[model samples]
Target: MTNPFTRRPGGTPGAHLPLALCAAAMAVLALAAATGLAVDGRTVLGEPVWLKPFKFALSFALYAGTLSWMIGQARRWRRTLWWLGTVAAAGFVLPEISAITFQAGRGVRSHFNFETGLDSTVFAVMGGAAYLGWLMTFAMGVFLLSQKRTLERPMAWAVPLGIAVSLAGMSVGYLMTAPTPEQAQALDAGLKLATIGAHSVGAPDAGAGMPLTGWKTGAGDLRVGHFVGLHALQALPLVAVGLRLLARRVTVLRDLTVRTALVVVVAIGYGGLTWLLVWQAQRSQPLTSPDATTLTAAATLLGAVALAAAGVLLAASRRVPARTPVAATR
Candidate 1:
């Protein structure tokens, strides 16, 4: 299908250039990162230097694309709204990716790096950009909430709720900025500190981590939660879209309220899972090896979702009437 977001004001392709351009730029960065990884054997924090850039570029590409498509669906003040969003992407968002890529080229950690003046400056820029970008996204979410929508029940909730969830996910990064025990001890001693914070909590930053992603193998890695939370931007809305597609084959999905209920259940479950990941990370537990407690929590969460889904389906079967025509749901 022709994506509406890729088009300009009158159904041509252009106007959302800031977001589209960011997506394109990220793709280029991904290519460059791939090349760098292949040619340069240098590793930072025990991982390939360009690896961070490669992961970040691909993620941002999807992030930007999703936001672009979402804002493109606006009916009221579309041009102005998208223009404002585009500007936000250009001004605040672009700097973030740029800083990461720049630090990658320098062969140093981009995050929590305050060792030197230049690294501190770059990290400061990234922090500032994060704040501004989040503020802009919140503003966009509010504006989206105010506008009337033509989407189905699931999608209608998905777009704005996805933004809300993404905001929470973005906020999760702040936890990584806090001082660890060692850093706190150094600060208490009034000694100069090179790095104030880190991604790994119980373990050191450059310790043994999972392949490719570099998530800490058996320690509290904040990145896991941050990654999971941030991607909900794509996950939640895409769930709604996937359900809509499934409706063609399953008659139970034809009821508007049923679909809405399912969306709510999934959203709640997704949010729960995000929190679970953060909780697990904070406890210094490796994601690959969740213990009994973590396993129980996860099982409980899954059970709740199943119960809720069964309730929705059962209620729909009794209340919505069997084989309700698809048109009636709308």
Candidate 2:
């Protein structure tokens, strides 16, 4: 069978490496995503188990693999490494900030194991690692696209702007984890890093029985918005790439196909923001005396919007099928 990467325009060198890495990351990410979905969906069918921790580790490895591939694909690995270092800096700093908050809450330093499953440490490290991986890859894409004569300018702006907005969301997440000034001085760095790591795996409540609560309760939940927004850097660009490849076959409609993907990504990214707002509102609802109606309503609204967006994306995808040359039709 013909290899996809090997066939890149002008038969570029080292194509095999990037393809291999992308394949590996995709395989692992798929497993993590599937496991998360199954566990979350089956929450009503059975009790959640510690075995689910595999998804967290697998997810982190996937993002790391993606970052490695992105940097390796660069024409100048040295320059890319600097950007990679920037992402790592954010990874370390965000956790330190979160640790300050986690400590301030008088919350126990939580740990995870094959026996008891995920806790705060797992959440922070996993989340931070994934963010690092994602940002580095996003920067690489921006750098690469700038060099491409066909894809300069627009992608230049979109890629960086998207990364910035996403990072802003991440910053919110880190802030949300902070507890109080009194407890900040006593924060444990190790425990905080672990929490960020666990969160790197996927979205909030992604796995079953992962009680969607943080040490700071309401504040941490709002950080889910950051996860959603920041991760879009990975999701949107990849979707656009897929869209462009698929559009290659329909010569007449290729431009339209690519534009549609961009539009859909922006719209969905915005939708994620709206969902985050709803979650923040829900998480912050006053108990007064242990009432849940407000939270329930907020969740319901987010669910409805999510469903609508999914429907629209499905419809759009139907219009632009993957590429297959006309010459091959015979």
Candidate 3:
């Protein structure tokens, strides 16, 4: 079967440019990874530079790939693709643009000690990156829902509405805490210690002990947000499939009931997984602990169960009752 996203109109693919850019960006990322690994020592490489930029580049490439594939489908899909492209650009630009403000104060200072000012420039850049990331999800949700073949109005709104609520809640919390200089310093110390213990915080190390660097230094609740946020990729898509199944039977009470139950099960499973992540972060235990190990195993099991149940429900919904052929009245 033809890939739904990649179908295009005439000769010479419309996405050629974007696809080429994606390939180039991926190549750059590969080079950066090799270079990062090949260098012997920290100082010998001068500054560990290419990796961060490469991440941004790869993000663009992924977005571009999505756009290239989607834009050629139909007018509606094309519109959706345009929005997605805008979203992708914003995701890449926001952090870089925000970094300018951050860099102005520190002038390329990437180190963090307790003495480092509370307004660490990288925070601004990262915050921008994160906010943009969420917005990208919102746009994606809209596009997914806009699928004329299978889109329920309520489900379509969920992505944007959920994001708005999450961001609002987070913003309210930020406003509530106007940390003192001393408090900020303490927070910095805690973060630094966690980073030191973890050895590597970010910039994907396949061998790195910690799978999640986002929760390394954060409190439980904060860590939960980051962890769940990370898994949105899986949770959202599963939920979407479930919703599509659920919406089909909305008019029929019996089938609707099954769908509703399926949706609830899916939501609860995803929510539980999210909560566990937060709890783990709050606990701040190393990944090697028996308890942590058990919890991870349990979470994986739950995810598998949820996915399996969803698939079963979707299949069952598609099965219509056998129809007898009508007698020839003529």
Candidate topping lDDT: 1
Q: Whole-model lDDT for model 3 versus the true structure?
A: 0.42
The sequence of per-residue lDDT tens digits that candidate 2 reaches over residues 1-330 is 333232345533233344244446445544654565465443311223322333333433433444444334434443545445345434643343334323322233322211123354545564565456455555655565453233322233344444555555555544444443323433453233222222222223232332422212322234456546655545555654555565565442254433443545554455456355535534442122213665565566567656765665566557644552322210
How does model 2 fare in lDDT?
Answer: 0.43
What is the Cα root-mean-square deviation between model 3 and the actual structure? 9.8
For every model shown, what is its TM-score relative to the native structure?
A: 0.93, 0.45, 0.49
TM-score rank, highest first?
Answer: 1, 3, 2
> For model 1, how does the per-residue alpha-carbon lDDT over 98-198 read when each residue is reduced to its tens digit?
99989988899999999999999999999998888788878887777655355566887877777887888888889999889999999999998879888
lDDT tens digits by residue: candidate 3, 1-330: 332243345522255244445546555654664465356233211333333343444444444454443344233555455556555555644454345323332434222212344545454455566556556646654664455343333233333333333333233223212343444576677643211111112221223232223222222223334434444433443565565554444432134334434544555455555445444433544334326565776668697767866675676557633331221111
**Worst ten-residue run, lDDT, model 1?**
1-10
Question: Model 2: how far is 199 from its true place, Å?
Answer: 9.4
For candidate 1, give the lDDT of residue 255.
Answer: 79
Locate the minimum summed-lDDT window of 10 residues in model 2: 107-116
Q: What is the lDDT of every predicted structure here? A: 0.82, 0.43, 0.42
Can you list the residue pairs that collide in candidate 3?
A: 224-278
Range of the 10 consecutive residues with the lowest summed lDDT in candidate 3: 194-203
Candidate 1's C-alpha lDDT?
0.82
